[model samples]
Target: MNGPHDMGGMHGMGPIPIEADESVFHSQWEAKVFAMSFATFCNYFPVDETRHASERMPPGDYLTSSYYERWLYALELLITEHNLVTPEEIEQRIAKLSQEEY
Candidate 1:
């Protein structure tokens, strides 16, 4: 739906810089996120749904989070909405990995 995420035909935002010969990915994790998102789509998650999920983020988040981070947030939303994983399970796993293991 129409939201702040829709920035098309807007003003105030600066012009986009076109880089000559931009790399497909600026880092390894970007590639991983790209692959993971594609695989998730292959499993039947509609591409439009994914876009809406990502775009529905708060305006601040939508503006500040990087491209892959936005994909991840959208993926999380879809996964939980579709019951692929519970929020608690996701949080538990995040906590486990976030802690020091050494």
Candidate 2:
């Protein structure tokens, strides 16, 4: 799918920083996202569906978002597309979680 996600063999993107001892996850949420995505893939959606959803993201947003952020977007897209949850439900849940954070 020749999208922005296909960055292979590109030039002038700058060198990838090699960390001496980087952890598998940079933060807790990344691990959570990964787990959530994995669970969904196991039970609900195919892996290719998630990949296509992520590739369907707007080019600017796709390029700017972090890896887990993209995964979250794709998850949301697939779930909403399949009527597992409405966008309103997702927003309501986010609001509930935000309130819990305070």
Candidate 2 lDDT tens digits, 36-87: 8889877999888888999999999998898899999999999899999999
> What's model 2's TM-score?
0.90
TM-score to true structure, per model: 0.82, 0.90
**What is the lDDT, from 0 to 100, of the residue 39 in candidate 1?**
96
lDDT of each: 0.85, 0.91
Per-residue CA lDDT of candidate 1, range 1-102, in tens? 676678788899899777799888888878987898889877969888999889878888888887888988888888899999899998997889679554
Global local distance difference test of model 2: 0.91
In the order shown, the candidates' Cα RMSDs to the true structure are 2.1, 1.2
Query: Which candidate comes out best when scored by TM-score?
Result: 2
After aligning candidate 2 to the native by TM-score, how far in Å is the CA of 36 from where it should be? Answer: 1.0
Pick out the ten consecutive residues of candidate 1 with the lowest summed lDDT. Answer: 93-102
Highest-lDDT candidate: 2
